[model samples]
Target: MPPLSRPPRETRALFRNAGAALPTRHAALLERCVERRLRGPAQVLSGHHNTNHVLRLGLLPAVLVGAVPFARLKYRVPRETVEVVPRIWPREWDVLRVVCRFLPEVPRCLAVLGDNHSLHVYRGGTVLSDRGPHGRIGEGLMRQFAAFFARTAGIPAGELPPLPEDWPADGDSDGFLRRLVRFTEERVHRPHRPRFGTLFDAVGIPEDAMARFLRGLHPLTPRPFALLHTDVHRANVVVRRNRIAVIDWELALFGDPLHDLATHLVRMGYDKEEQARMTALWAEAMTRAGRAELTAALHDDLGAYLAFEYAQSVYPDVLRAALALPPHATADDFHAAAHRIGHALSRAREPLRLVDVPPEPHLIDALRHWHDAQNNPATPR
Candidate 1:
């Protein structure tokens, strides 16, 4: 028999929706932004909301195209002219410049392609997430992270790069706190509008509770601030040639040094035993660095930051849970989303004044409605 004829090539779609729980755009502009920096052809590897469209060059180098904060909006809420403008991302680039200068366990930035993309000497490494670190929660991994943060803490503020224009000019710690609270309110909580508000209402978060919680959190002592990676979960750490390399500096912030420890303790998925060990290791390291004062109230104050983290997380968590459902979602999808969102709301209940976490069935209806609305062109914002 004659050989079967090969099919004709079909053009790829600019946007991909299938198999993706969240809506994602190809970002041809960003791809071109990276390609301009390369000498030859580069093949796209992967693309997602939190991550850039990764492209692999012929042999070694890889390019990353970044996405704006919450770029993948589930609900297209109307925004004022002021709200449409983007914040300065040069801060992250400047942060990488500082980090690579001091920390050896980070990818070397090759070029800043633009405000939203950068080229780095891609350290061919395995992301630790694939290794079941979250499952094992070993002491060795905790120690490694502890030491990394300690070394980062030692990088003097004077030696660090200058702050961006929008950052508090006076360097007031309270100013930074207020900024964070505003960010939580305006960026995370506000963007989804009526749905986000409705979710909070159903959960029973009091109108003024979040504000009161922010005010109640006052630092008891004076301690110097340090740079923090701010999102140090397993996915951000890569094991390259047996050395751990941290990536994704877009969320870097300067604040209470102890806040970094708190963020790590919560975000790293450490169990009770591992959390205790990690806390002790962090305290010991800071104590050795002559900053014992920084952690003086960690046991007491860390709770406040952890609460803030959980509270800030609820918006994304709920949206993500809802988005995880497919078109005409099955009962199993509803159950799964309910479990995840309910857990998030429970963690944030105290800080957000959530009187009660809603039951699974209610979440199912809320999520199903929201999911369906995302597909409707004329859905109310």
Candidate 2:
């Protein structure tokens, strides 16, 4: 699809009519933002699921205008948009502020309007779209990315608000992996029926193996919580001047640094060889940065965590495809999508075994109970 363009007169009119609150101060910032734009023709940067109307101007690079409140705007003159949430704008602003102080690679903050939003100017560069060849560099880039996060994670949590109250408990390796595995068993495997041709069947998750596999696995625990960019995927990274520029801070939380690494590894779709290469580089970087012990355990924790992540994705993928269906879509549409995701999850399970990490003892016992219940007609409920 082509990049999106500015809204039509009617569209703008509709926005105005929709009663979006236009901040008085934002009006001045919007004017200044447009004034700072390059003289060349501007184009709308599309393909965003967020509520921002993103445009690339010749002089300014990228500008994002929030469509909801009508006046909130952010400038990405030097880089791409990472994330925007009004509630945590202060925290994000503080993070960017600190990062810019230490890292020259980050874009410069031009201005922040009110307490809720800001604008930044970044130098532009190429973004890797294809997933195959970039795998090697992507892995190294992720290590560099981890190093960047480790710096922030080292910050004393006592100085912050004890991490956000809603932050995922998985910041600890054990909790993170256990939740992932449990989510898979309860949400994906439990829903399967013989007649349905569920994901397990499609992806070939062996009915017999599921029990033993889950039983033998143990969650690896890592000490010390660090600042984590929880959503570090291929899409969130940009390659500029031989260095990787990480974006998307909305999912930033205080947690296990390896979780971020694992999330990137899984999302980037690196093969086994590539994964090992990346993990080694990441471990080296962490070790050099004085996080050797945590880095060592991360290698083991990643395996179980990945299984959990893959299984977790199954439900969301099926749900997303289902929600995309036309209102009149038949029951078969939902079933087909669910089956596809289930199979994908099953295939994902194979890789988890390859990691050579074991599951937690409680989880092993639970899997055994579940296994016996599946086979025994009179098994306890």
Candidate 3:
């Protein structure tokens, strides 16, 4: 390997290859992380899919660097995605390389330890979730977000990675949205039904919920496609030096840019007024980027995407909420879990065409019953 830099293609190949070995220091750190022996200047963070540990790599053996460098190692696990976004291109590492080549605010992906693990330059900052910034953000920050959205939308397909044969042709907004809806139904729900099916039924989600939702979507207007950071919620955003940087490109995809906007608008927990403000900002930015066609369906198509987000999210939200119930959960725990599941189901009701959501008491009873069954699978009903 070149000491300084390698071509992007070679680098991408190296990162994608699961057989490749991590550097000695990185390898040691990964081993410690796997063994849960990580000590000194280390922090462990977990999401549904990956257990991430941050390590201070210090310095190169021969180099005279003054600073203690840091990198985050991600260990893969059986993660779930509620995005329902199509991943036609490569995942996070490549997305970062391509995106950061132009937009530097995005966290740089250093390397992939192996198939399921990755190393990223650990940018120092507090995650937005930790900050819990409520209400509208200032104009400057909003501009930065708008620019990030536009820049990502303008990325050329030629520069990234090869898309699958099933990917819709450019400007096929209809096809793109259809693929997403299909993914939520066929890819997400169908596969996990055997496991979460009962939980879903108890929550009043019918097997044909997505089918009914899809039928109500309006005809999509043609819009140019682009790369999207589909999971850009507060947790995935970092606030450093008065600027916000996006991380976790694992759910990144190439699709209708509005889908990206919709995801961000929802995930950020923006209020109704703030959502309108953001929509305006995004429209202006897209138009300025000479991608006016991308926003043509803003009035109607955006709602479809938002509905889709709420619709698909219910499956994961219900399953995750139920799974989160502790073995010996208290009444308060069950109440909290029930409230959470009720909210998700309530938000999803319109799109999914649910007849009625169970009351909190009913939800609590159902959850307890589900948890009991999970613990005592051998005992017949």
Quick one: best lDDT, which candidate?
Answer: 3
lDDT of 1: 0.60
Tell me the number of clashing residue pairs for each predicted model: 0, 18, 0
Better of 1 and 3 by TM-score: 3
- Best-fitting candidate, measured by TM-score? 3
Model 1 lDDT tens row, 1-381: 421221112211211111111112333443453455344443333312233434443211111122122121110111122121123343455666667767866755443433334444455578888787567556666777877887787777775566667875433545655676787677666666565565555544555555856766776344567777777888778886667877766567776766677778777787778778888998888888677766766787677777777777776677667656888788888789888888888878777766687787887777766666666747653
Q: State the lDDT at 229 in candidate 3.
A: 83
TM-score attained by model 3: 0.85
Model 2 Cα lDDT, one tens digit per residue, 1-381: 423444444544533221123457654756565555524344433322322223333322222232322222334322232222112222454555455545556554444444444454433565554333344564456567657666665555554434455444633666644544554555455554342233233333445433545675685665566666666666666677667776645446566677667767777777788777777777777777787766756656777656655645544453344334454444565455445544445545554343322233322233334334445659773
Residue pairs in collision within model 1: none
Could you arrange the candidates by TM-score from highest to lowest?
3, 1, 2
- Which wins on TM-score, candidate 2 or candidate 3? 3
Error of 1 at 56 (Å): 4.7
Residue 209 in candidate 3, Cα distance off native in Å: 0.3
Better of 2 and 3 by lDDT: 3
